[model samples]
Target chain A: AQSVTQLDSHVSVSEGTPVLLRCNYSSSYSPSLFWYVQHPNKGLQLLLKYTSAATLVKGINGFEAEFKKSETSFHLTKPSAHMSDAAEYFCVVRTNTLTSGTYKYIFGTGTRLKVLA
Target chain B: EPEVTQTPSHQVTQMGQEVILRCVPISNHLYFYWYRQILGQKVEFLVSFYNNEISEKSEIFDDQFSVERPDGSNFTLKIRSTKLEDSAMYFCASSGGRGRPDNEQFFGPGTRLTVL
Candidate 1:
């Protein structure tokens, strides 16, 4: 089984300040990880994905995450926080086998980000 | 820029009533998925559909739940009898293929079902 744990349930950042949200995952094998953002009353928007090809992944809106195998972590970060960045973020793990035909994804509890202007 | 679309942004139903949530996935996608998030909880996968049949399903997808691709574009999840615990935001998602590195899923806004 695969699972992800987000360290923070809520994080607050001031506008123009750095932002960070921590996540750690457990998988028996190499895994595919992703970060998604959901705004109020809206659907999930893919921020970035780590497909094992890259250790550092860059996402839209100036957000990025580094996949550290030693730490078993994939933490999302932003150079500078924007007021519009306030939303809920989720870290996901895919439990698909290398030779399987089906795929299932597990999502984290989610971290709510608040940006103060 | 194609994306998934779901119908009935919100639905309120009485207990034991049947409810069907509809979605239209991307035109060329071959994999469809249904997931739900209870209030203040993480998103949980319900089922996955491929080739007009169920490819995978979770324990939560019991006998009361069924899925159908009635038409070429429509994917529907039907709950025969609703329970208070069933009330949540259901999201439909689709991917172009299975297990591909770039086969990222696109999601719909979701339908909020309230079982009263």
Candidate 2:
């Protein structure tokens, strides 16, 4: 069984400050990690993904996450927080070897980001 | 920018009534999925479909739920009996890869199901 844990249920950051949302994952094998953002009452949109090729992955809207094997973590970060960055962030894990292509994607509970101006 | 599209932005149904949520995935995507989120709750995986058949399903996807790709473009999820617990925002997503990083699943705006 694979699972993901988000360190923060909510994170508050002032504009122009660094933002971090922590996530840890447990998987039997090397995993595919992803960061998704959902605006209020909206569908989730991909922020970035780590597929083993790059440990430091950059995503849309200036968001990025670093995959640390030793820490078993993939934490989302942005150098400067913007009002648009305020949304619910989800850390997702998926097994690369799962027979069922769709069975492996597991979502973390979520971390709501609040960007204060 | 191709995107997954879903119908019935909102649906209201009585308990025991049947309901269907529809989606049209990106034209080139091969895998499709269904997930739901109760108010203020995490999104739960319901089922995954590929190659015209169900490839994976979660415990929540019991006999009451079924998925069908009636045509080349449309994927549909049907709930046999509506329950108050089933009320939530149901999302449809699609991807183009078999596994790993290339398989980015794009999601639809979702249909808000309200069961009375």
Off-target runs (Cα >4 Å) in candidate 2 are A101-103, B97-102
Cα lDDT of model 1 by residue, B18-100, tens digit: 99999999988888999999999999999988877888899999999999999899999999999999999999999865444
| Model 1 accuracy (lDDT, Cα) | 0.93
Candidate 1, what DockQ?
0.66
Please compute DockQ, using alpha carbons, for every candidate against the native two-chain complex. Answer: 0.66, 0.64
Return the lDDT, model 2, position A112.
97
Most accurate candidate by TM-score: 1
TM-score of 2: 0.95
Model 2 C-alpha lDDT per residue in residues A2-75, reported as the tens digit of each score:
78999899999999999999999998888889999999878999999998898999999999999999999999
Error of 2 at B4 (Å): 0.2
Q: Roughly what TM-score does model 1 have, to 2 decimal places? A: 0.97
Docking quality category of candidate 2 according to DockQ thresholds: medium
Global lDDT of each candidate: 0.93, 0.90
Candidate 2 residues B1-116, lDDT tens each? Answer: 99999999999999999999999999888889999999888888888898889988889999999999998999999999999999999999988754432477899999999999
